[model samples]
Target: LERIVADVGAAVVVCEAATREKVVAAVPDGAVVVAGDATPASGGEGGFAPMVAPDLAAVIYTSGSTGEPKGVTLTHGNMSFVADSIIESIDMEPSDRILCVLPLYFGYGLYQMLTCVRLGATLVLESGFGAGGRIVQLLEEREITGFAAVPTIYQLLLSLPGIGEHELPHLRCLTNAGAGLPTPVVRAVRSAFPDARLYLMYGQTECQRVCRLDPEEVDEHPDSVGTAIPGTEAWVEDEDGEVAAPGVVGELMVRGPHVMQGYWGNEAATDRKLRPGRWPWERVLATGDLFRADERGYLYFVGRRDDIIKSRGQKVAPREVEDVLHAFPGVRDAAVVGVPDDLLGEAVHAHVSAEPGVELEAKALKRHCAGSLESHMVPKRIVIHAELPRIGSGKIDRRTLAGWSPRG
Candidate 1:
């Protein structure tokens, strides 16, 4: 918290009654502090202060693949474009009641509220997705029409006992972003919420959302993250800076008004992310995330450029291997990473967890992978765990998995 406060150069800190002491201690000496319980100041003479599109809106930090949190600076234009794009893509209306459990500090959750305000839609907040039974109840009781969350939240929802029997006819749309859901999880989500249109989206803190797959195309292109969100441009570029041919993997690039202003107070990091585009004044984000595209221009996330595992002269995408692991029966969570090896350069290692009461054998999972993936893509070693470690966003902690002891 201190690092973030310093990095972002925060002048004023806000806290609740419970955290006032801790927050006061964390903030710098001159920083002003406001407690949630403090009395409101009387109205001043000045009217509403105007804000331009380019004005800074918020700075949300994300734990990038390196495990270092970087503050992403977003502007009014970026937030507006994203909110409008999402509102249109999901066909959200004023009557829609959106349920959100993701933390508001994160962009995905913060936008849910902004989008609701823009649409005049009712926003229902939940503390978290713990146990998920209460979420199911909230869905039915609130008559929620729209819901958005990461893939892990969806997995927990599906695991709830008697989830299928719960009728959620009013649940019109269910959207997944932050990470792509595996094909089997897609099918399961569709089955569980027959009435909701499942939208598989992909994005990062650098840009709130890059693309979203249509519900109709999900079954056919389960692996795809779909086309770019309305008005945005997303494509894969090879190492030579040329557009990668369909099926060829390259770093994903995003260009549009929705791109962030840059990282807060970090010019070097900002320059690294926002590179020169087509024109002198233009800048485009080099996502540093590797992806491949289908002939139809649908984007499929491979892995982070840093996360790819080179094994036996073959480049293995952890996401591809994870998808296969997700398809295995009783598997609830899976994470794969590259471990040092003498012969393979970097050997593929997977850590997986099973559903409650289900026993998973590393050897059996290896056999399962053998039937579905190439020899090089299969895990050289598999570790079974009660649950895979995750970051705040609920995505698997690949950095932690990569640093694990071999004996485990």
Candidate 2:
């Protein structure tokens, strides 16, 4: 936190009572501290000026699951464009009440707040999804019309006993974007909240939102991340920098007004990601994610470019393997990674957590994978855990898992 404050050169910080002392102690000398709930000081209107569209609005840092976090600099125009797109795409209204469990510092959670303010909708804040029962109760008591969560939170909600028995007529919209919600979890969520429309979205902090799958199309393409969001263009480009044919896996590229200006104090990294588009002045984000589009132009997430495993001389997408694992009877969540192997340049390895009160064996999971996945894609080794390790962003900590071995 101190490093972030120094890197961004923050002159002022807002904190609540709980964190006021710690925040004051850590902030750099001469930095102003203001209570988030305290009334503003008088006589501040003399020098105030309205912010312009091009002015920097927020700097949301990435999850840093892979390495050091990069600050994604978003302009007022970027945030406004995405907010409008979300309101239109989701058909959000002023009368709706949205429940936000994600951290406000994260892009996904921040957008929820921005959209609510834009439409004058009610924004219900929760510190965290403590338990499934509590979340369900909030949905019922708060009369939440819209809810957003990542796959991990959804997995926890589905694991709760009698989750489907709970009635939530007020839940009209469900959005998942941090990570792709497993196909099994998607179906289970729809079954539990039949009245709510589930939207499968895909995006990165560099670009607020690139695409979203319409609720009506979930069944037809449950695995797809759908088409580009309004006013944005998304496509897959191959190694040669040409648009990839449908079903051909490649890096996902996004072109739109929502792209970040650049990484804060990291020009090399910025140049690597945000490159010039067709026009000399235009820039497009080269998302470091692997994706494929169907003939119908629906996008499907393959895996992170750095997460792909080359085993037995064949490139394997961990998402494909993880999907099959998610479908297993006793499995609640799963993660797969590549391990150094003497025989096959790298071997496929996996870790999975089972549903509550269910016993899972590595052999049984291996058999399940054999039934669904190709021999090369099958996990050579499987480990069961009470719960998979996750980073702050709710994504599986693959970097931590990468160093594990059979001996350990």
Instruction: Write down the lDDT of every candidate, Cα atoms only.
Output: 0.88, 0.90
**Model 1: per-residue Cα lDDT over 1-408, one tens digit each:** 788888888888777778888988898887777898785454478866899998888998986545688999888888999999989887889999999998888788988999999989999998777768888889989999999988889889888888889988899999998777888888988888887898999888899889999999988988888999888899899999999999999999999989988888889989999989888988999999999998889999989888889999989989889989998999988888999999999999999998878899999999999999999999999999888888776777888888888575
Rate residue 64 of model 2 by lDDT.
76
Cα deviation at 225, candidate 2, in Å, is 1.0
| lDDT per residue (tens digit) for residues 33-119 in model 2 | 787678645546677679999999998889877667889999999999999998998889999999998888878999999999999
Off by over 4 Å in 1: 39-48, 406-408
User: Where is the poorest 10-residue window by lDDT in model 2?
Assistant: 39-48
Off by over 4 Å in 2: 21-25, 35-45, 405-408
